[model samples]
Target: MVLRAVAVSRTQEDGGRSELLRGTGVGPVGGLAASGLVLGMQCALLGVGAGTGLLALEGARPADALAYGAAVCGTCALLAAATMLLAQLTTDATGARGAGLAALGLLYAGHGVWAAERWSRAGAWSPFALRGAIDPGGADDWCPLLVAGAALLVLLAVAAAAARGRDLGVGLIRFGLRHRRPLRAGGPVTLALRLSRMQLLAWAVATAAVAGVLTAMGENMVELARRGAVEGGVLGSLLGGSDPGAGLLDYIGVLAGALACAQAVVLVGRFAAEERSELVEAERGTGSGSARLLSAWCLVSLLAAALTLGAAALVSGLVGAALLDTTAGDALRLVAGQWPSAAASAGVTALLGGLWPQARWLAWAPLLGRVA
Candidate 1:
């Protein structure tokens, strides 16, 4: 009787364990699959949109649209696969997060360098100027210099971040050490502040720099606008028919800033995911609460967007004034003009990150749309 009772207990325990595993596995798999489906659909939609736009502009045939769509889809698929592979290879959370941040910084710096070089070599010529400054030799001379300098800057930043991350044994830029002692005086807000302090600071610095750059660039844009070289149409209407090269650079910077904001959103969302996936439970068992955790995560996301975008604007304004002999006041005004759109994009992304933790796949939509 004793042996039979023990055997029955063991059987029941095994059955319960199996049930638990099966139930738990379903949510993760389903979430991942859903995310994948959303991503693929968004990519397809982007391709279709781009193809349609191209057709409308050129009055291309259906076959032309079809070909363009196919190319876009193929490119999206390849990029998606590459991103997933990179994520998989960096299985360690700290490493993965660090890599993502590094990539954002590198992309921003690279695009900036590209813009500067292109403007310098193209000699204030419009893109449609068929007879102007088509010096292959000038491009060859400058392109390599820009690429090398940008690459070096990116590598240095990555290496520095990686070293710091290794020392901390966490993500390079993330805060919040696993606290051991219980809170005696201050409450959840205090905890959140402590946790997100580093991230907020990083965001502030990045945004300030980006804003400065944008402001500087705007001054130069105003000068170009004064010149009648730029045409007066839809494109001109938006960029004030400024130096086409400068306009292109401004657009690129905006796109890069948007991308960086998106990345920040994803990083914050990952924090929520980690919490939901049992990792946070382990930390909570030690003393953290949901309010403290969520606050810290959200704060980081907001700060990142504000700082990086602000920096882009500032830099553009400063550079525009110095390079194009525009007044500082005018550059500031242009930077101010761009704020609403930039803020809207960043705000929407941050809100999405908070509301839909599992829907990070959606962030890729804007990026894919750009590519298309």
Candidate 2:
């Protein structure tokens, strides 16, 4: 979503019709479609890479890998369509990221809730169940893929309609309440915080939801661990030796840290958007020196990323302590242990963005490779 917004800003810099025509030919919606094409191609390449890696294993077949790659690409395109639709619906870049991620959280949480309750053939109905259809199961079921395609079409249609209703650069609908009075005082740091607050809030809520669900299923996790699922893996050793519950909590903390880094990538993308739109230079012209503005941008984005991760850990720890009979101190401390890694990720992104803004996208490569 952040990328989509940046593409929009880049395609229509300064909201000028000449640029829009020269860059996108038609309008903002066309620019959005072009971005979707690029993203879809990237997703296809990633899927092919993953499938090729799988095929390199001893028992893997080339045909199966190719099929899975195709399926994965289709799934990625559908998901990208949904994200682009959400990006088009928002009035600003930050709002696009916040809304797109929040929607993803809800979709994933809804799938978890549905999976937890419906033990039967619920895969046919869950919108976020693309993993099942693409993985080792290889069941040749195309219903879920068809559903995703339908959803993609719907999202594309709606986004186009919304775009048609709005002006060239503005959104179809605005978010938030308007203040009557215009008297306010804020520096660069404050403005950065304000821009990133919604993104932080959305991530916090998503993390809490995930943690709550994990806590609720503590007994099942314990049973799985006792069944030797948690005793034979490197992850288990890294998490803890024997106590599966604590190990699980730590594992989640590690994942949360990774997610925090992903959020940092989104922040860097936002910085790119601001630069494309000349917002950074305007701020400098308004008396915020270039060095100070850069400092505040990095500091505030890093702070927002760090604080959101901490708050999520704290919330999840409290919930685990309450529902899973775990000590709050242990849970909080274990989760906090992962914060430094996330902080380092944010720092790396900030450094890349500050020193070599043109290559800021490179900062995502390490973290994304780790994830893949």
Q: Which candidate comes out best when scored by TM-score?
A: 2
> By lDDT, who's the top model here?
2
The TM-score, computed over Cα atoms with residue i paired to residue i, of candidate 2 is 0.85
Tens-digit per-residue lDDT, 1-372, candidate 2: 334434444334333532537564566567556666787778779679868987887877776677667677766666566666765567655666667666666666666666666534533344466657655435656666676777778877887777657665556666544743552438887787776776777887776676666555555656566566765556457434466667767766766666777777666556656776778887877798766776676676577666766776776678777665567775676665666666676677778877888887788787777665
Local accuracy by lDDT, each model:
0.46, 0.65
- In Å, residue 7's CA in model 2 sits off its true spot by 4.4
Q: What does the lDDT read for residue 289 in candidate 1?
A: 71
Give the per-residue lDDT of model 1 (tens digit) for 13-46. Answer: 2224323534666432333234335545765786
Per-residue lDDT of 251 in model 1: 59
Instruction: Provide the lowest-lDDT 10-residue window in model 1.
Output: 1-10
> Which ranges of candidate 2 are over 4 A from the true structure?
1-19, 22-25, 119-127, 176-183, 227-240, 268-272
Q: What's the C-alpha lDDT at position 349 in model 2?
A: 74
Q: What is the lDDT of candidate 2?
A: 0.65
**What TM-score against the true fold does each predicted structure earn?**
0.51, 0.85
